[model samples]
Target: MSLLDRFEQAFMPNYGVPPVALARGEGTRVWDVDGKEYLDFIAGIAVSSLGHAHPALVEAVSRQVATLAHTSNLFVHEPEVLLAEKLLGLLGAPARVFLANSGTEANEAAYKLALTYGRREGRSYFVAAENGFHGRTIGALSLTGKKSIRDQFGPFPVDVRFVPYGDAEALRRAVTGDCIAVFLEPTQGEAGVVPPPEGYLRAAREICDATGALLVADEIQSAIGRTGHWFAHQADGFVPDLLTLAKGLGGGLPIGACVGFGAAGTLFGKGDHGSTFGGNPVSCAAALAVLDNLDLDHVNAVAPRLRSGLESAAHPLLKGVRGRGLWLAAVLTEPRAAEVQRAAAGAGFLVNAVQPDAVRIAPPLVVTADEIDALVTAFPKILEEAAQ
Candidate 1:
C-alpha cells in the first residue's frame, strides 16, 4: 500500500487524512513525496518556530541525543534546569516551572496548580472565555470553551463558566471571589487569530487581583516570540500568576511548561506532580537552541511588512487582516476559506482555513521578505480562482 494508505490504516481518524504527505523541509519550504515544493505557512501549527531543519535546532538535538536523552522526574538534568532558568529569565518574574510534553499537558499542570491554590483559599469555580481552545486532555478540555468538542467529551471533572471573549465587563462579572482562576489567550488562535482590545489583559489582571483569583495566561500559540514580543503578555505590561507554554517551545520536538509567578510559585510542594518524558534532555536542548536563535529584532521588523502586505489587498474575496506579528489571519468576504486553501495549495502555497471565513498564517521566524512578497502577490489570484 501507499504511504497515505498506510497512514490511514494505522492512525486514528481524529485529524482525518492530510491532503499532502511532506517528505522534507528546509527554511520556509517543504517538498512532498512527489517532489512538489510549497511555501509552508502553517509552520506545523505554530510549533516549528525556527523553520524546518534549522542548523541550530539540528545540532542541539543531535548533540543532546548522542549525550543524554531521557531522565525521569526523580533525577535532575542540566538541559531541563537550564531551559527552566532561561524561560524564567524571559518571563522576567519570580516563578517556578513545571515541564510537560505538550500544550495540553502544560495547561493540565496549570489547572491542577490553580486547583490546589484555590482549594487553599476555599474557591473551586473556574472561568474561561467562549470559543477558546485549550487542549484535548480532560482537564484542559474542561477549560476549553468550544461546545462542539466539549459536548462530545461529556461528564467533565467540573463545569467551567464561559463568557464572550474580549468582553472585560463579562469577564469581571464571571470572576468573583468564588472563582479560583480565569484562563485566557491574549490572542485567540483557533477562533481565527482574534486579538483582544487594548488593555483587556490588564483588566483581567486587575479583576483577578481584586477577586483573589489566579490569572492564568494560556500562551500556547502566542508565546515564544511568535508575535514580535518574547511573551505576548509582555506587550500588555502585566505579569500573570500562572502561564502555560508549548507549541514552539521545543521548536519542533515536544515540550511544554507551566510557570507560576510570585505567590503562585510557592503552591506546589513535593509529590505534587511529575512527568516521565516531560523534561527530556534532547527536547530541552532543542528548546534552548530555539531560544538562542530567535531574533526578536527581525520579528519586529518583518511582522508589520507582512501585515501591511495583506491589508493593502483590494480583492473582492479579501475582507481584511487581523492579528499581531507573524501570527495573522486573512479574513475572507465569504465563507470560501476551504476553497481558498485548495487554490493556494494548487498555487504551491500552504495555508490553513482555521474558520469558515478565515485563513491563518504562521510562517517560521526565518521567513524572508521575498517569501512574504510571493504570498502577497499570489493571494489576489488565489482568491479570484477560489471565487470562480
Candidate 2:
C-alpha cells in the first residue's frame, strides 16, 4: 500500500484525506512528495508569518533543541521569558503573559481569566459580537457568535450575549454593568477578513471601561504584521484589556499567549491556570527568531507591494479586494469559492475560501514582489475557471 493509503486505513476520519502530501518548504513555497511546487498564500492558516524553513526560524529551533527543549511550569526558561518580553513590548501596556499551544487555547486561557475576574468582581455575563470566532473549546466557543461552529457543542461553560459586530450602538446596548468582557477580533479573519469600521475598537474599549469590563481583542489571525500592524487593534489606537494571540505567534511552531494588561494582567494568580507545553523553549525560541526576522520593514515596504500585485490582477469574477498589508480578501461575484480555491491550487497558488464569495490571501511576510506577481498572473486563469 502507498503511504497515503496506509495512513488513511489506520487513522479515523477527521480532516478527510488530503489531496497531496507536502514534503518540505522554503520561503513562500512548498512542494508535494512528487516535487510539484505551490505558492503558499495560506501560510498554514496565517501561522507561517515568516514563511517555511526560514533561516532564522531554522537556526533558533536548532539551537534551542540542541540546548534545552522543555522545562516544568514551576521553572522559568530564557527563551520563554524573552518571548514573553517581546510580546509585551509589542503591546502598548505593561502586561502579564500566559502561554498556550494554539489560538483556541490562548482564547480559552483568556476566557478563564475573564470569567474568574468577573465572578470574583461580581459580574457574570460576557458580551461577544456576531460572527466572532475565538476558538473551538467550550469556553471559547461559548463566546463565539457563529452558530455553525457552536450549535453542535452545546451547553458551554459561561453565559454569553451576542451583538452585531462593527456597530457601536449594538455594543453600547449589549454591554451592561453585569458584563465581564466584550470580546472581538479587530479584523474578523474567519468572516472573510472583515475589518470593523474605523473607531469601533476604540468604541468597544470605551464601553468596556465605563462598564468596568475587560475588552478582549482576538488578534490571533491579524497580529504580527498580518494586517499591516503588530496588533490589529493598534491601527485603531484602542488598547484592549485582555489580548489573545496565536496562529503566527511562533511563526509556524505551535505557541499561544494571553496577554492581560493593567489590572487585568494579574487576574490569573498562582495555581489558577497552567500548561505543560505552554512555554516550551524550542517554540519560544522559534517565535523569537520569527520576530527578529520580521518587523517594520515587513509592514511598510513588502506588504504593499504584494497587495498591489494581487490587486493588479483583475477578472470578471473578482469584484474587489479588501484588508490591510498582507492580510487580504479577494471578493468574488459568485459563492463558488471552494471551486476557485481548487483552481488556485491547480494553478500552483495556494489561497483559502474563507467565505462563500471571498478568498483570503495572506502570504508570508517574506513573499517577494516577483512571487506575488507570479500568483497574480496565475490568478486570473483561476478566476476565469471559477466563473464557469
Candidate 3:
C-alpha cells in the first residue's frame, strides 16, 4: 500500500493526510517517494534547525542511543545535565530547567509552574494575548487566543483573560491583582510571524512588576537561534520570569523545556510535577549537536540577504515582508496564501500558508544564500500563477 494510504488507515485524521510522502532529506532539501526534490522553506515547521541528516546530530544521537537511550525522572543522567547546563549558559541566567517531550508539554509544565506560584499567593487569574498560539493541551489551549480552536474545547479549568497583542494598555488593564501570570510570545509565530512593536516585551516586564504577576514568554517557535539570538527575548534586553521552549532545541528529536528564573525557579515543590521520557538522553545529545552547529554569526550574516531578496522581488502580488532573522512571513496582496503555497510546491519549493494572506518561511539555519535565492527567484512566478 502507498504511504498515504497506510497513514489514512492507521493514523488519526487530524492532519488530513498530506499529498507527498518524503523518502529522504539532506541539507535544506527533501525528496518525495517518487524522487521529486524540493527546497524546504518550512524546515519541519522550524524544528529542523541544522537541516536534515546533519552529521553532528546523527553521530551524537547514535553515540548516545548506543550508550544510554533514556533514564526516567527517577534517576539522573549526564546528557540531560549537560544539556540543561548548556541551555542555562545560552540564556546567561540562573534558572532551573524541567524537560518534556514537545512544545505543548513544555507549555503545560510552565502553566503548572505559574499555577503553583499563583496559588501560593492566592492569585487565580491568567492573562494572554488575543492571537497568541501556545499549545494543544487543555490548560495551554485555555491560554491560547484563537477562538476557533479554543472555543470548541469549552469549560477550561482556569480563568483566562484575553487582550490585544502588542497593546500595552490592554494587557495592563487585564493583569489585575487577581492575575497570576501573563502568557505571551515574543513574536507571534503561528499567527503568521507577527512581531510586536519595539519595547513591547519591556512594557510587559514593567506591567508584570506593577501587578506582581509573572511574565511567562512562550519562546517555543522563536528561540534557539532561529531569530539571530539564543533566545528572542534576549535581543530585547529583558528577561521573562518563566520561558517555554521546544521546536529546534532537539534538532529533529522530540524535546521541550520549561525554564524558570529567580524565585520562579524554585516554585515547584517535591511532589509538584514530573515527566517519564522528558529528558531522554538521545534527544539531549541531538540538542547538543543542534546547539553546537547553530552558528549565530552565520545566521545573522545571511538573514538580511534573505529578507532583502524577498522584499526586492517587487511583484505586484507582494504586500510586504516582516519578521526577525531567519523567521519571516511574505504578506500577499490578496488572500490566496494556500494557492501560492501549492504553486510554490509545484515549482519544486516548499513554504507555509500560515494564514489566508501570509506565507511563513523558516528554513534551517544552515540554509545557504543560494537556496534562499532559489526561493526568491521562483516566488514571483509562483505568486503570478497563484493570482491566475
TM-score of each: 0.99, 0.97, 0.99
Candidate lDDT scores, in order, read 0.93, 0.87, 0.93
lDDT of 2 by residue, 59-132 (tens): 89999999999996979999999989988887857888998999999999999889888889899899998998
RMSD of each: 0.9, 1.4, 0.9
- Residue-wise C-alpha lDDT for candidate 3, range 1-388, written one tens digit per residue: 9999999999999899886799999999999999999999999989999999999999999999999988899999999999999999988889999999999999999999999989999998999999799999998998999998899998999999999999988888888878999999999998999998998899999999998999999999999999999999999879999999999899899999999998999999897899999999999999999988889998998899889999987788899999999999999899999998999999999899999999999999999999989998888899899999
Clashes of each: 0, 0, 0
> Which segments of model 3 are wrong by more than 4 Å?
none
